[model samples]
Target: MKKLITVFILSLLAFTAYSQQADRFRFQMDLGAAAPKGGGIGALVNFEPQILVQRNLALGLRFGVAGLAKDIVYYDIPKDFTGEISANTSFSGTANYYFNYKKGKAAPYVGAGFGYYTFSSVNIESTDIDPDDIGNLRASFAWAPMVRAGVELGKFRIGAEYNFVPKSDLQNIAGEVIGQSTNEYFGFTLGFFVGGGRWGRFQ
Candidate 1:
């Protein structure tokens, strides 16, 4: 994780240097919703800093957090178990390509990102199980991949993205696999961005 963060920072520095003569540096904030697999809709937030290195290409770093929660109940047993599952904190680096780079006109874009994700464990509380038997149920660090598409109009942007994190086994304090979960979700965002520079004839 440390190595990955280091690499992202170094690459951002290099890109910033290379974009010195480019069009603009963009800073954007996104607020949206996330729908995780088997979970209800949750809130999502993202902060991105990007530099346009070309007429149609931009490189950026994305830091975001999303949370999902769902209530669970166990049946078919004499003892009843009920609790909730929560997932949070995702960060990534992204590159986007704009189809039309004209100012004052809406430009549609597509992008992909890769990053590290951490998720909290499923917490279960039941009338039958003792509190002592409940231990931390944690998930390992997961490699996440995402794809996004959006339209940018003037300073406003709206987009949707889907993140794919493979199924991870949930482990207890005894290192026993008790269950498995996948951190896959779809998100929609609305953002406002500010930047200065010229892309072609549009300033």
Candidate 2:
């Protein structure tokens, strides 16, 4: 039993070392559209700088914001209250798992992670009956799941990710706007990795 345990420990250490040696460092940026299902669309942009913590594991930060234009149509209303909504700036973080097909200059990967997105908005154009609406939406504890397939070129990386955030309330608004929405932001990142090492995080 003692010999078996010792061998197991040594094997674990070797695996860890191998894993570290096989990792790639990268930085990414993405831009796309934040299209809401409710006849609203916005420009979505995100910048992510990531550190390959280990094989298949990456830790990063995402900083971006979106501006949504409202295209609402009223049927029973006397006057049409058509206006656009500019979503306030919001932020979030990310952790991803990269599956690099090859350990070359161009490595393609796919992974997913959870995020917390903050959304806020004010009435861009309101009808005459609509008061000076100071709307603030709070979806603080939001879930962000994303799937990305992109190529990593040396210290710079470029790819597109389809990020989805679960439906939350559009704060400071009248009506329960609780549902899921898509971030629709595609990233094109350009940054270099420190501590030059071989990309071999895949064992």
Candidate 3:
């Protein structure tokens, strides 16, 4: 969590420095739900700081957290293993282009971003056995590409996004590959922006 905080602070500072030079700034907070490719549900939260670089173009940094839980079952053995399997922090740079920039008019936007995703280690707990016997599961970092489309109405924005992360092998304390899984997910978000110099016009 400390590493996540440090990355967020650095990204925020970068946004602040760029905001001073830009004509307009926008800050957005988002809460959403995510569904992974397999069979799991997760919660997502994001903080985005953006600057309008042009009338229809904006650049921003996205700091996000996601936590997912799912059930794991073995084919030969019948056992119940259900717990949080994935928790991740993401930091990305984004660029968005708005189709319509008229005030009070709904603006549709399509955006893309690239980022690094850091997944935390998770331990699976089972009621049948002692938790200490189960080893910690570690996941690797991957480069994630994101694509999103959204509509901004007044100060509120609704969007859907897809994250593409390749499958990464999970490792144990002995550095042996135990399983392979991807962190890819689809998310729907509702957000509100607090600051923007003007609704549609850029200075």
For model 2, residues 1-203, the per-residue Cα lDDT tens digits are: 24333543564454345444433444445566555544555676665545566655676655555676644333234443444445434344567655564456556566655555555543435444334343443333455666666655665556556556554433335554522223334333333444322344344
TM-score of 2: 0.55
TM-scores, all candidates, are 0.78, 0.55, 0.85
Quick one: ranking by TM-score, best first? Answer: 3, 1, 2
Q: Which has the better lDDT: candidate 2, or candidate 3?
A: 3
Model 1 gets an lDDT of: 0.72
Off by over 4 Å in 2: 1-26, 70-93, 101-103, 124-129, 133-141, 170-203
lDDT of 1 by residue, 141-173 (tens): 788899999988777889999999776776768
Candidate 3: give its CA RMSD in angstroms.
2.8
Give the Cα error of residue 145 in candidate 1, in Å: 1.2
Query: lDDT for every model?
Result: 0.72, 0.49, 0.77
Query: TM-score: which is higher, 1 or 3?
Result: 3
Candidate closest to the true structure, highest lDDT: 3
Per-residue lDDT of candidate 3, residues 86-159 (tens digit): 55888888998888846545788899999888888766656674545446777788888999999888788899
